[model samples]
Target: MCLRGSLHGPSRCGRNEGRDLSLDQPLLRIERLTKRFGGVLALNDVSFSVRKGDVVGLIGPNGSGKTTLFHCITGFLEPDPPSHVEVMGESIKGKGPDGIALMGIVRTFQELRVFRRLSVIENLLMSAQQYQEDKIVPRFLNTGVIRAHEARAKERARELLELLNLSSSAGKTAGSLSFGQRKLLSLASALMPDPQLILLDEPVAAVNPVLIDKIKEFILDMKCAGKTFLLIEHNMGVVLDICDRIVVLDHGERIAEGAPQVIRTDPRVIDAYFGT
Candidate 1:
């Protein structure tokens, strides 16, 4: 009844495997990804590709391995052997989170990851600093190079604050902001690194309706600027509106995939979300 594996078989997911990856390569490629927590199979040999500049939504019922797949792809959790994640055709199977970030992939959590104590501007600056300067030595030496780096980071942070409409709250403490504002801040922080592909986990969860529209608009704008995104969102309206394609999973296996309209009518997808 769970449809542990449906018509979308394990091997079929990675059908593009043998193609020439050099031409029109995907920004992110997941191959036979599997994850287990003790005896529980959280993800079962999942595979998919996110093309450059496309907004792809990952959706399913609760416990359908949506976030688990994100964790494995972003390096927060490692997959079992034979699972592979590729960025620009290079395997990142063993890379840690930081390493993956340095490779131009950044992510946000379902729960906001804002620094509560830091001011809005400071939060963005800290995120910018991670990628803009030498972390350890620069802090201690206080050389001119570090000073210039911090200045550049501050400038970039200001630009992001403006772009994200957080300029008004630049001096406010992150913890003092409303929940919706914190969500925007978390997304802005991830953008600080100017990553190539952003993996967002439940970005619109718990957000109010008005803020949801704003978030959707912002994502569309970013995509127009050529940022590729892989997002996990439960709001079917948002997913169908913003995503060019969608992947649906059930019981740790992918049950359906295609354009939003096709997926909307796919019986397999309907069964996965609504149950038999």
Candidate 2:
């Protein structure tokens, strides 16, 4: 991997590096991945794969290491040496967080992060910065180039907001919106990257039903258009309704893996949290 004058594609593999692989390859592959913080292993030998166009649910009670697994995948938490993580089948473990993001994996936080004072459209514009051209001098001096790119991203942002039913608020200040609106906006912010696999850390948590429905609709539409997702959620109804498959983790390990009904009936899942 080398950096010439500018960055290309996601990761540091350059623009054409991913062209050889099929578009439908399992968008994310984690193998024998282990992450330890000092003495204890937060995520012990966790392994999973997310294929294109599938919605996989990651469920577990608190302390199940679900969030830690996400951190490892997103490059927020590095794996112990001698391990590998591949996004769209390309090794991305050592690439660092931004590099991983450039590799076509994007996500939203459990707590929404956005430009509170900026307009909804402005928040989206900032999210699109990952794809901006590298020449800062040209961008600063050339008003035309900046305007063109800005307008283009704004148009795309409008489309995304409309998909989430936030189009009407496009010109409003992001901070002025309701809490649920901010949650949906956070999701829209992640999609600005056109990522292949999006890691959602509790997208529906603390959101009202209206915003929850909005998030659900957008996720379904993305799946229909061939996007992959591994969602971390506590809302059982939403998980069962949208997931093609479910993976349950408890106390830092996998407890069950199957369809929603099988998972619902599993004694282990019930005992883990629901109680016998």
TM-score of each: 0.87, 0.86
Mind giving the per-residue lDDT tens digits that candidate 2 earns over 1-276? 111221223321211212333455677787777777788777766677776767899999988889998888888888876557897679985787788888888888887898999999889989999644367898989999989877777777877887778889999999999999998898888887677788999999998888788788777767665567899999999998888778888877777887787899999999995668
Off by over 4 Å in 2: 1-24, 131-147
- Candidate 1, residues 1-276, lDDT tens digits: the string is 011111112211222223354568889988889999999999988988998878899999999898888888878898997798899988887788888888899999887888899999999888876654247775667778677767776776776677667889999999999999999998888887778999889889999998898788667767756678899988899998888889999999988888888899999988778556
lDDT of each: 0.81, 0.79
Error of 2 at 146 (Å): 3.9
- Model 2: lDDT equals 0.79
Best by TM-score: 1
Deviation (Å) of 9 in candidate 2 = 27
RMSD of each: 9.4, 7.8
lDDT of 1: 0.81
